[model samples]
Target: MSDVVTCLWGRAGWDRAAQGLLGAGRRLADELGGKLRTIVLGPADEALVTAAQAVADSVVIAEDETLAEYNPESYLAALTAACQKFAPRAVLLGNDAYGQELAPRLAHRLGGSAAGDAVELSVADGQLRVTRGVYGGKATAVIALMKSPGVIWVRARAMAPADAGAAGEVERVRLGIAADPRVKAIARHVEAKEGVRLEDAQLIVSGGRGLGGPEPFQKLQALATAMGAQMAASRAACDAGWVPASWQVGQTGKKVAPQLYLAIAISGASQHVMGIADSKVICAINRDPDAPIFKHCAFGLVEDYEKVVGPLAEKLSRHS
Candidate 1:
């Protein structure tokens, strides 16, 4: 079997995180003395193929009617087929929902090892090692996968996207995989969103329970709007019904790695800090001087949010 490092693309198509996977995959392949391959689900248009071809040594398109809807079973089957055909040394998937569900199952089907939510990867003594957060982001742990075709789902914004240059091979493979009859997608509800997604936001303004109630989110939103940043909430705010569940960011919610994360009135519990661990710069403003958030922030201000938010919003609006 030829040694290869494989990365998978999801149903929605190639995103920044997926591009980051290519960069990571390319590194893994180089360390293993192998080639980098990418498997794209559904139809891959000319633009998609051209883009992927620039980084990967080869690209495999797994096209099937069942692949249109994101059914775990169909995806797993197609991915299995690709792995069997490619005989990769390792398979990298995104840490998002799609990869979280498929990585383990694909490993089980292929009789290999599996790990998820990995932040770092490396090859030592020809074995694949994965580094990930543990204890709700209080610490980190590293594990080595001894099995062939080590399956890993990488965290978002783990690294920069692969630099494009290679003129790689491209081919399409049809896997006659059918959807699982037991799990029919009867309906789909897409959350309406504006501006950049939380995972993809460069600047983020997040709030917490200390804001006292849902009304404070309006002020936070105003600041976010003036700064052209996305708004997020801690679990407390979401649990208190102050914001939509989709806006929550924490261990139990979404993980973000923005360039700047401005946390207002947040206590910065470990679970919440876990989500923003990858953020480049963290800033906190809380009335409580001893709030846990101050410990983790690069810059912190101790002041009542009511007194600080209005002026901050006004100043930011003026500057904009």
Candidate 2:
């Protein structure tokens, strides 16, 4: 057993963010000369176990039918128990909705500190340091945690996914789950989405106010379909009701780090640019020569989006 322990809390299906957390946990374990343990709540699933074993040194499963659906109170109670028993040096969670709520509460229970939306993590001289954006993603700040069992909420697409390695052992843990009368989850509704998920897409085609209206988004969607990419929108487009809120991408929306990001008619506001700062390449299309997106993009086309988007879509569709 290692003196230092790094624990990662994973969801059932193991989405990209979960994979990223596992990858980050593995690296942290290596850095601290510790062991990597993944904690999964819910019934046993082979796929979940397999995914967890790909990167973890051990998979700790808290099996229960009640865990099938997400209940923040129940999850918090289970996690609190696990952390107490495991006494990990660090705990990592995704910076998603659940994590945003759980991390701070868990840290409070553990008498430790919590940090969210961490883009970079490192340890030196027995202190864990995290780098993240501040001021609505306008700048960066590095935070150092002096306490043990540091709780970190990792940002999506910030860390590299862990490659397949030696399989890990699976351990089962039991925790008492009590229902909270304060909150009850009556129903769950999932919105239907087509094509690739925005966060998981390697290529993203985003539209902004320059598209004129929602009807023009169809052209962008066609381009996205042709390129096998996900379609996204700026806050302006979402606020204009041209697209669903789920399609928005910015500091106020989902953060993306696609390999290639296409910004059509977006003015590249600071809030919007902050989300795609990690994209490997950015291509901007706007009619205004002085559009702010041009400065931050690798490729720029100062042509009317109406004239160019249709042709571009056609070209890609033919090739595809």
Candidate 3:
């Protein structure tokens, strides 16, 4: 059985698959000793086919008028149909909102067990061994599967994309209408995709309750823009609603592995530190010299955040 993983690329159909998911998909593909397959659904989705060719070996299309808009049931129907026909060794999905909800249901229908939020996978003694992070990344529990085929949902942005320039290939799969059930999305509202998302940024600059209020966040955003960095907030600032929940950086928020992390006025709570432990370098700015963040930081500034943010922003502007 060849390895088969699906790329749920954004709906324009031609745009490149989300870079974050591509990494884990490629890793699993190589480990499984087979080429990866990608799937996208849309109307006139020629572009979706074109872009997926770069990462996956084959492009499967589920083109239906009703399927143009994403309804979980419709997608599950078409996807399950495809997998049953081919019967891949294993199926992989991202640990995203959609993936988390769909993978378990798909596994039940396929008559297999699914390991959620799997961060590690390897070929040990011929069987596919999966490692799932348990207790919030404190320990990794290994899972062995004896069954023929199963499903897995790996965490978001956990793996890096592999280079397979010449291996790209494309194919098409046509599907008939799938059943539509009780729940229906009557309307779809799309939020504007703005400023670097937490997943894609190379660097993150964060502020905490020390920033005073929502007014200072404008300056932080300007600094983030000038320095080509993402703006993040500690749980405190996020609870205050100075920034969106999506921008929160902590154990409760998105974990980031940026090249650099700048902490201004942050107290360095362990909850906050957990998310940023993967950063290449950390620099904390706080008035107190004994702040806990300094212990983990590579650099430290014992000064008021309001004072340093402006100067640092200026210096970054000049260098940029």
Please report how far candidate 2 places residue 72 from its true position, in Å: 1.6
lDDT string for model 3 (115-134, tens) is: 77666666677677778755
Residue range 1-320, candidate 2, lDDT tens digits: 22233334444366677777888888888888888888887665677689888888888888755565678888888888888888888888877678888989999998888988899889877888889988756689999987777898888566888887958899876676776666689887787967667887899999999888999999998988888889999999999999999998987788888999999999999899878887889999999999889888999999998888888889988987
The per-prediction CA RMSD against the true structure, in angstroms, equals: 1.6, 2.2, 3.5
lDDT by candidate, in order shown:
0.85, 0.82, 0.73
lDDT of 1 by residue, 46-162 (tens): 777888899899888877888877788888888888888778888898877788889999999888999878888888887889998898777889999989779999984666677
- As for model 2, its CA RMSD to the true structure in angstroms is 2.2
Preferred candidate (TM-score higher): 1 or 3: 1
Lowest summed lDDT across 10 adjacent residues in model 2 is found at: 1-10
**Order of the predicted models by TM-score, top scorer first:** 1, 2, 3
True-structure Cα RMSD, model 1: 1.6
Off by over 4 Å in 3: 12-17, 43-48, 146-148, 166-169, 249-257, 265-282, 286-304
Tell how far residue 234 is off in model 1, in angstroms: 1.1
